[model samples]
Target chain A: MATATIAGADVTVDEEGFMTEFSEWSEDIGSALAGQIGIDLSDAHWKVLNFVREDFQAQGETPTLRRVSKVGGVPTKELFQLFPKKPAKKMSYIAGVPKPHGCV
Target chain B: MKRLLILGAGTAGTMVANKLRPRLDERDWNITIVDQDETHYYQPGFLFLPFGGYSRADLEKPKRAFMPKGVNLIMGEIDLIEPEDNQVKLVDGTTLPYDYLVIATGTSPRPDETPGLDSDEWYKSVFDFYTIDGAEALAKKLETWEGGRLAINVIEMPIKCPVAPLEFIFLAEAYFAERGMSDQVELVYVTPLPGAFTKPVAARYLGEMLQERKIGLEADYMLEQVDTENSKLISYDEREVEYDLLVTIPVNMGADFVDRSGLGDELNHVPVDKHNFLSDAHDNIFAIGDAAALPTSKAGSVAHFAVDVFTENFLDYIEGLPMRGEFDGHANCFIESGRGKGMLIDFNYDTEPLPGKYPLPGVGPFSLLMETEANHWGKVMFKWMYWNILLPGRELPLPALMSMAGKIPEKVG
Candidate 1:
């Protein structure tokens, strides 16, 4: 892991730039992380990101897109529209949580 | 008398019973195993069923035959697992109480969970090789298939025997060639993973094999639904892969009783301490096998290794002592690469599968991460071992924890 400046906040990140510390995140920091990955945070995007953040806080792991829709009251089709392709990875990167491990 | 109640008489449940029975004295411990059926499927055999390699006799046996002679075996569908009362309710109105509960119902393909998957085209064009019926249907389909684009899609990750889909494609590649129709068939391996597998070295090794056989790899696909009307797979991101023969591994979930018990994750898998398979919530409840949300492959190899650790730790737990075993998440798989050639992979939680001789350093009868004829025989011989040695709880020479002794570690891996 390495520390980097994102949105002018010091944060630790893994080799793939996924946030190591979930506590080092704010709405401004999330937007900066989103901007780096070419995503603009709309209310729709925040709707998904916020759910992922809160759910991860509760479940203690990154929630899959299916869980966000099924348990968090968001439709899967809309998540695709908001986070676009690769929502699982992109959402985790912006939400400042560890990316979901490809559980073998 | 103290009671030990184990649910599901599949690979894990059966193994747990056999391992614990001889150790837990009959005078003091009363062990009872419950399941919905009597037939114990040699699940690893299911992969070869599509190729007409085995019949019902070779793949199945009575669960009673393997019981350790002292344990009680109950057959009935589970209605609910009442963890609070420490009892399980069967659909037949029988309630079996236990001092300790082991949930090992395992996971199964839930095609109905996805739209249009279990519909009109099921067993007609779209198929799944995870079940006996599906494998038999696929076998018949292959017998006279006028080949076209054959797409093997994995609907989700953490599916049982994750290598089976790749093995299916490999066997299909060789099977079509033997029929003098290699050109007539187009094989595509579609998965949500970015490559042939989750691990780096194995994926590269397996990915290269796919390229050599001229099979297409469609990766990073998370399915939204199966479009039965058009005979195609529609991904969540609007990507589409049209196919003629779709062999899909639909979303695999744990038993419904787990969900009803309010003791499961989103996928209905019981949350547990990974090292010991102890329930995160209730102290008396433990879930082993695919029923537990383990971070490793849900293959029989994992169940075997995990059961070994759980058995030892369980012996201590009942005595009110701390579990001394820290399970390393050891798992191995034999990948059938067709034409009497297969590959072996061995690894644990901290390590990815690497190339080396397995079980013996520089002198393995079977090799790891490289396809060979010996590996194929190892897989074939494993069936005999599974019935005679593995499920019966007889000791195998192999260690429960993974060792790097035979492995040649490399930076690239």
Candidate 2:
């Protein structure tokens, strides 16, 4: 399993998505993933990313865009900009869910 | 040369403008609305604002944005209403003559009505969620606060959205729990109402919920004054409740122009027939929403229903026909209880909230007087509906009249 840093939190990822531990991540891998999705590891961005991940974990399913919007207080468009491809799937990816079928 | 002039571009005034704008003949009759401010606030959303659930932008929009195209939006303070002359004087020294007038100028929070409430502790320990500023400020205070005794006080009765206090308490519990500070924070609810709610069944249910959540209840406490220096709210007969943080629903009073015009009752609300919504003081004038002293809840649903009736009645008057004695004082509200669940209540002048199925009879997606996750979704979804559907003068799928189709009839003697 490979790992990366997203929004200052260390995260592990396999061929599917996020893995469990921060220790598996390297600085280069973290910066590459951050570059793939144009977002800085700012505190505000971390707050939203962490909240969405936590909400998905508690609900045991991926959250819809509106649910993420309400809890994060971030506009859907701005949230979309942070995760260019399949924001919901990317949220799930960062949240440690297996990449769903048909998601790149 | 007949014209209609409406005052205050809040919920009530905006509804009247939209409802009548389509019905009135633009060539023969002109419609004008007046208000000092430019923005219209979605008040129900204000309850969520203090919890970082909403921001100022989400709660407000340009008042003119929602107003119908045919109506003239007059942005100015109303200096006086000369009812005898059928004229309204604006602060800009302009006199507007009207053949008929609709006073929809709603109420304002009077925190100063209680002694020392507006003192040094005004926005510090003591706060109100009625205004944008108050809600935003309270949000900041709630963020860092570790824990202490937190009291939600209703200074008196007849405040807009009566159930908001209870919602605040419910959401607060969820908020503290989310922040892992639930154990440190103590919750108390103080109100003049004899029970946790106005109705019996809901009251008992909500009161028990309060207990379950470890929230203290002090009912029938008529507030005398705020002893700010000591951080205590004192009641008549010298009873006192101390709080590290005090959130209050201040005394709500009607429009200032009503008092200026001497056309209102003790609280400056216009006297109108409780059923008909016609001004008792004048034949051509009408009042609706919170401005009208109706013996119903001062709520958005009430205004929506009242405007539905007012539209029909006004059309009858224009055609020189008899008025229909409709308007059953119907009001429906969804109460948010946090933790992804909520309760729905539907009642009117003659009926109180009773447990039953709603809108679909036995197959309801919503249950009255019962808490459910679907009801919570309904409450959250309403904000979108308010902005896109309700405010734009669009007709919704739901009927304006309260229906008993989903409700089981109460057993009677």
Candidate 3:
């Protein structure tokens, strides 16, 4: 775990560049994190990112793609379109949530 | 008298009951175990059945045979668990009240969860070996299946015996080779994980093994649906894998009654404290085996190890003493890599499998993370142990928590 600057704001991040502190995340910081990964933050993308952000707070862990699809009301196909390739990892990265675990 | 209600007399429930029956006074506690089926399946044998390694007869026995004499075995389907009322209702309209409840209703492979998976092609071109019927059907299919592209796909994860997919593909390669048709048949493993396994060291080792065998691995493919019309699998990313025959490990979920009872996660697995198997919502209720949503492989090995720790802690809990045992999510599995050789892996929640000997420091009759003939024999011998030692709640020679004694840790960059 190390401190890194994103969107001109300082935040703690893990070795994989995922933000460690969820409280350090904001709309501006999120957009910059997305920009670093070559993805622009759209409302469609925020829907997933926002859901992941809030769900992590409540669930005490990251929500799986199934949970995002089933409980968060986001279809998996569209999540793939919004984030591309690996939506679960990318969405959580932008949302400043821990990497989703447990065989998802 | 305090009634102890145990649901689904599978591995965890059976072990818990057997371990406690001899200890709990018959006068003070009324122990009752409920299940819809009377037969207890050797689920690990299901993987071997597809390879013609075991027959259906070798995998099943009367559930009551393994249970203790004093415990009441009730055969019925669970309709609902009213946690507030501390009672469970059966499908036959009988209500059973309890002072304590244990949900050992394990997870199952639900092929119908995925669309086009349960349609006309099911058991014809598409198959699953998770269930007894599926395993038997697949065995017959393999007996007559002409050589073609055989694709094994894992639709999702947290499936019981997570390593079975790798073992299936490996055994298939050997099976086809034995029949002199290895040249005609192509094997591919389609999985959601990015590599051959979840852990880094084991994944690298297993991934190399797959490459050496020339097995094609389509990684990180999140399955969306099966297109039976085209005889292909469609992913959420719009990638399609066409195959002559498909063996699928579908989305696994816990008993539906868990969801109906409102005491489960999205997959219907009960939310339990990882350390003690106690439910997060209710203190008196506990979930063991695949029913508990622990961040580990839902394997019978886990259930056994957990029952060991749970038994010790439970004995303390009933006496109003502080429960001492803490489970480390220990899991040990044997991977059949074809031939007469197999590999064994043992680790806990915090530690990944390392290359070493198990049980014994260096003289391990079993080697970890490497293939050996002894490991294969150890796996074969486990059947007798499961019936004689494990189910009877006899103490295993192995420790409940993982030990780092024999392991030589490697530094990977």
- Using Cα atoms, each model's DockQ against the true complex is 0.72, 0.01, 0.69
lDDT (C-alpha) at residue B363 in model 3: 81
After TM-score superposition, the amount by which residue B91's alpha carbon in candidate 1 deviates from its true location, in angstroms, is: 0.8
What are the per-candidate TM-scores when only chain A is compared? 0.94, 0.54, 0.95
Ranking by lDDT: 3, 1, 2
Instruction: For candidate 3, write residues B94-135 as lDDT tens digits.
Output: 999999999999999998899999899899999999999999
TM-score of every candidate: 0.98, 0.78, 0.99
Candidate 3, position A27, lDDT: 93
Model 2 C-alpha lDDT per residue in residues B340-362, reported as the tens digit of each score: 89999888877777778776778
Q: Per-residue lDDT for B68-92 in model 1, tens only?
A: 9999999999999898899999999
lDDT of 3 by residue, A41-102 (tens): 88888888888888999879999998999999999888999999999899889899888887
- Candidate 3 versus the native: TM-score? 0.99
Q: Rank the candidates by TM-score, best first.
A: 3, 1, 2
Residue pairs clashing in model 2 are A12-A19, B361-B406
Point out the higher-scoring one by lDDT: 2 or 3.
3
Question: Could you give the CAPRI-style class of model 1?
Answer: medium
